[model samples]
Target: MAKASRESGTPPVERAARASLHPVPDGRAPASAEAWALIDSARQSYIDALPIAAAVLTEQDGDLVVGASNRRYDSLDAARPASQPMPIIESPTIVRRLLEFFARPGDELRFEWRYGDQVSGRHFHACISPLAQVPGGNGRCLLTLVDRTTEIESTRSLRAELLHDSLTGLPNRTAFAEAVDEVMASNDGARHAVLLIDLSRFSRINESLGGVAGDEVIITVARRLISTLRAGDILARVGGDEFGILLRLANGPDDAPAAARRIQSVLSTPFRLARFEVGIECAIGVALVGEEQTSGEELVRNAQFSLKRAKSTGRVEIHHPGEAACARYKLDLETELRRAIDQGDLRLAYQPIVDLAANRLTGFEALARWTHATRGVIDPGEFIPVAEEAGLIVPLGRWAVDSALATLAKWDALAGSAVPLTMNVNVSAIQLARDDVPGVIAAALATHGIAGSRLTIELTESAIVQDPERTTKALQALKALDVKVAMDDFGTGYSSLSYLRRLPIDSLKIDRSFVSGMLQDRDKVAIVRAVLSLADALGKTTTAEGVETIELSQTLAALGCSHGQGYFYAAPLTADAARDYWQSQL
Candidate 1:
């Protein structure tokens, strides 16, 4: 029991309770003490049935007296000793609000209150409703406290999960946009930029190493990127091997490029993984925030558009005003290209490969051509790279192989084995890296009833140099299938001559740049002669591309080039035209 107040000669709660039970007035019958006790017991019983903590409070002398309460309500102060009376509303702020609610006849007050620390404490939603006034003593109110601690913690955990990336513990794309939104909303005329960094050739790492190694690389990149940022900047893992950075530039848009250079510098050093050390490069794209920007997501999208351009140009690119439309058009084209490949709607054009020495038709190079139903004749230069970047090249390559082989079969039936010509199909690096190229070729050959020797798989130096060991293995597999492998567009990429010695390269297709003006350009002629000399020494055949004139053809033949393909021979033709041309040559 609490000690009495000497001035009042009574305990505070007892005095307040006695003050609340004053006699009734205005012709009302004075209720018996027993009846009043029964009424109080019924109120206690009613509140005890409530799921949450509940109590009936009466206002006395600007303070709340607990007239009746449930056991749950009493448990709120369980830390206090059993000798002391239970306190109704411990928070003075809550008691003040309840007192205010008592003054209003029909008003209800609702609020949230915490029992202890802001972060690690119990939370409760407190609601107080005014009850009918006590007979001339004080107004009464019912207070209920619903514990919201579990619910609040759950919400906090869910929000954290949603906002954070599981792999890197950085902000994800969604959370980055929210942070960008906050920055935009609070912008005080300061310039900002979004830099999207894509780790170059990252898929190759995943292919050469495992996905776990790839994840390690991504985590390392995230950490290094964080090291290059200012205190106010935000960095996020927006993609598998791509990151987005939001910067509040201290010195306008120029700061973005500087930051990009800094990022590159940090990432320049090779990463030491579990097994081996590997080097990496990145392409950065920047989109500056402008007054005309609509939202944060739009800015991030613009940054992505710039990133796409950066991948192609191999430089840091900024988003221009009209780039969005260009990006959308490219997206639409990619969609159409995917649909075209799936439907077998794309066409193949056969360009003749001639025997330069004999001046006779020996084979044809299979070139993929798209004659869009609505937009006629899309250039291969336009869509080929698009297919490679969009990861549609595998299916596109498969379609090309099947179509070309089927065409060859039809031509063979027409020629009746009179002309034994080869069909060369160009293969992209993406196909070699991600697909079973030899298996696909074997299946296509079997399906078309064509011998593997008659099919030549043309590969660019870039394709071979991406993963030399894998490329060598794939080429060896193709060699096992007895398919001729020609290095297409040779001498264009940064391939070492040692690769030529090590790889199972049977023929070299001299790129157009060396063959187009060999007669007029002595340098080009010398390069062609050297390529031919090298091919002859290596026991490999040489084919000259873009030999557009008879004089150039003679020059290449004199240089010991075995085959030639150019405008001088024939342009890429349709299935019927190619058959007619071959028959004419016979």
Candidate 2:
């Protein structure tokens, strides 16, 4: 009984765990007792030349009971205990599946593993394969290890390229969304905040100094923003010249505002780019994690919503449940306005321009009007900027031109030389910059079979000042078409004499702010008189635009204003009302 007890002293696991040398899977002949010496000699010569070092393991049972490991495998986990598990560490799920593959004797397992310490994370390469020629007979697997820091860096660099902006090295929008998704998926009930930093006038810098300068500005901004945030906070370039920041661990909702303020303070310093020192203004929108928001997409949209509100109201805005409702309203309004433009719900009202010398109606300017099917009247002042921002102005301007020209054609037929009047249509800077504008006007004139002389186009100085080269070209084309061009809001801008001489404009319409206060304000009177004298010297006529009283009208006439337009004659009226007034003037 004592002999039997001594025989069974070792556990079955320990007995099964035996180590033996095996052949390398180098397309090598099987490691028979006869070939061991030859294989060992050839392997030693090339082993150091290659980056890979391989070891063979034998699995005894289905329990991942590893048999023997070669020298290469021993070095990989030299820090691990000899009794510890094989396939040392890395991506857990991948390791588990690879370990389970031992059940199939002849099957191969190929995978890469990463293992390291705190200072150097996951910087190893490993691949495993099976080479057993017989079922359950010396079942074997091969593992290879490589420690190439260059390979590690190359892989990391490729990954960074995939996820980061090429110019600024900030995470791109896709990576940013993934981060937001990760935060939301944690579901640990920790509050998070997303802040969208929108440059209010980034386009001005782009247009002024060229796109190269714009790119430098974006890179500079990204570096400054990274420095502004805590180590846990994430900054990404989510748009052209727009940045998004995520507060990874926020104490409360107020953390978002404090972060924004710090960033704003940092940006208060000017960015020196090449030859120019530039300062930029930014509008910030913030959204905080709460019970109501459940997804990253929702959080991003809420931040964008806050951004729009901030831009509109000129302040930093935070997302509230009410903000969503307001966003829905704004989106609804934008969609309806688009449809209103396309479906002809937009129309024009005509206001008279009278000749002060003859005291007769000379022409009428067309002003845009819109009425909602459910909401009654919408003011132009409220919606015009919206139209401009949406790029709906070009289409809107075209429609207005067609409508005014068609009405003028009918009016000309009715008047029949008794009270022929010109038609004036307003054009926006968006339309002026377009190469198609002159073609549109030419088509409208042809469609109505009307003379271009009967059409007068009005433009503000701001419209002409931007993109002067393009503006001058469009004006030259209009003059070629024989249409009169009037610079509206003349004295309100810094209009250079050289600018006026460069274009073929016909008249100046003095801004009402000056005209309305001219009687009581000497500075206003001087501006009016100076504008009138300048127009005369330039051989261009002057139209006093806000003659609300008879005294103002007579004063404008005494100041040698060529025409007068405003409530002194009449407010803007309907087309039929305008027609009747022109008929009565005859």
Candidate 3:
């Protein structure tokens, strides 16, 4: 008994002797002294060799008793001293689970429990198996415990890493989305707002420095943005240079823009990046959570649409109803446009540019037109911006260049001579910046056996002024090909004479707004006259747009406007119609 007790770390003989209740209460015969001794010896041997904590629990009449327990089991309770041994089955939860396991009579029953405080808790998985073979030990069970603290803590760490940004240690998009959902669901009565912040020209940082420097900038910006938030606001790194914030507004929708301004104010200061102090600007979009905006994803998406608009205006924009729907439609349209470009499903229409004095067709400006599979006639105004945003402008611009030059070749073939027509193709700022505009134009001119002098590349004022140095280089390259360059919508953008003289431009297309009412509006007339005078002085020609009346055309010609294009000449026409129009003009 002493040897067994020493090995098992429990005085089994004393515990069995002190037991008042009988195991054979139903009148079954009790085991012999030698048989009980043998049973105790086997139980001690089973738990003694086990690495984990082990114990034998048995039911005596209506009460529970510990039949045998190993040294490891006694050590499970940190509060108990080594000199004083106590059974680890003292927990009420463990006891209840063990009692339930005893009644189940299963092969094995498993459960988990924790000890100590939540922050410093140790977890354990306990398994119980029936030991029904012991005589007068009908409800006896064997229990073993496996510590699961390390595994549980490791799983929690991984989960935390997944939801947080590694560099900034901020919540990630998924976690932020989840948090937004929870906030909305929990407080339906209160108003909420979602703000999306996009760093303007953020790519310049990464391009000029490196990705490591970009990461540092983002982290610093994240900290600065957090400083402007309220107590309940949730900020997350949602994109490469985008951050999202969820604010529970106390005063309603009006608070949204104010919060945005606060964020902007915090970021107005320059950031000290390495040895360089760089000024950064941001565009913010706010979307109020209406009754209809129930999900976090929807709110964030609406805010994103607003953010896109804000980027253009460099202001804090609030989301309006139907904007989300419009944004989604644009997204779908962009995808379709990409497919259309790949499949050559797009075509161009030509609008005649007439010589004001001679009333003769000088050239045709090629306008892109798309007829959807079902939606017939998609406007260039709609899809052009989408293409620019989605980076599809490069390929689309390439295709347009080739197609326009190819049409010019076909027209030359039909006329039996090189038609004195210049194909004016509209080129986007994105094409100038990202695409090889000069190379593309040169290749198209070469492919169609067309002279570069017969092609004119039209650009918006905004396009030229975006990156003037780069634009000048690109324009110089195009000039080397002997192609003409015309600035479209001349008066609307910067309109700096410095740019006019610096660029190797041949003509300027007066914006339709100024030309539309130039005959009546004195201000419009003056603007047109000034543009014409400037163009003539720079040795460049001028094309007056939106000339709808004979009086307007005569008036423009009298004012020395070299060319005009509008309904007065012709609407944009197909290749066949354009050829016919040119032939008739002859």
Name the Cα RMSD for model 3.
Answer: 5.5
RMSD to the true structure for each prediction, in A, is 7.4, 9.8, 5.5
What's the distance in Å from true for residue 190, model 1? Answer: 5.4
User: What's the lDDT for residue 286 in model 2?
Assistant: 91
Q: Please estimate how well model 1 matches the true structure, expressed as its whole-model Cα lDDT.
A: 0.84
lDDT of 1 by residue, 1-586 (tens): 1211111223444544554466676656666656665666566578889999987777666656676677787787664334333343656557567756766658788998776656556788999987877566667778888989899999989999998899999999889989888877775424788999999978988999989999999999999999999978999998889899998789877898899899999999999977688999999999988754678877888898889889999889888887777777788899999999888788999999999889999899999999999989899999998899899999999888999999999877876762588999999999999999999999999998899899999999999999999999999999998999999998888889999999999999999998887788889888888898999998999899997888988878887899999899899999899988988988
Give the candidate number with the greatest TM-score: 3
How well is each residue in 1-586 modelled by candidate 3, as lDDT tens digits?
0111122444556434433234555566654555555666786787888999888776655456666777787677645434334335655567677767766676688888776557876788988888754434447788888989899999999989999988889999889888888876776524778999999878999999999889888999999999988887889998889999988787777888889889999999999889999888999998888765757788888888899899899889998889877877998999899999989899999999999989899789899999999988888889999999999999988888899999999989987889999899989998899988999888889889999999999999889989999999999999999999999998888857899888899999999999997777999999998988988899999998898999999999999999999998899999999999988988
Error of 3 at 373 (Å): 1.4
- For model 3 the TM-score comes to 0.82
Candidate 2 clashing pairs, residues 3+ apart or interchain: none
What's model 1's lDDT at 173? 88
Residue 71, candidate 2: Cα error in Å is: 26
On lDDT, who's better, 2 or 3?
Answer: 3
Candidate 3 lowest-lDDT run of ten: 1-10
Regions of model 3 farther than 4 Å from truth: 1-32, 60-62, 78-90, 132-137, 154-178, 188-191, 195-246, 254-284, 301-314
Residue 302 CA displacement from its true place in model 1, Å: 6.0
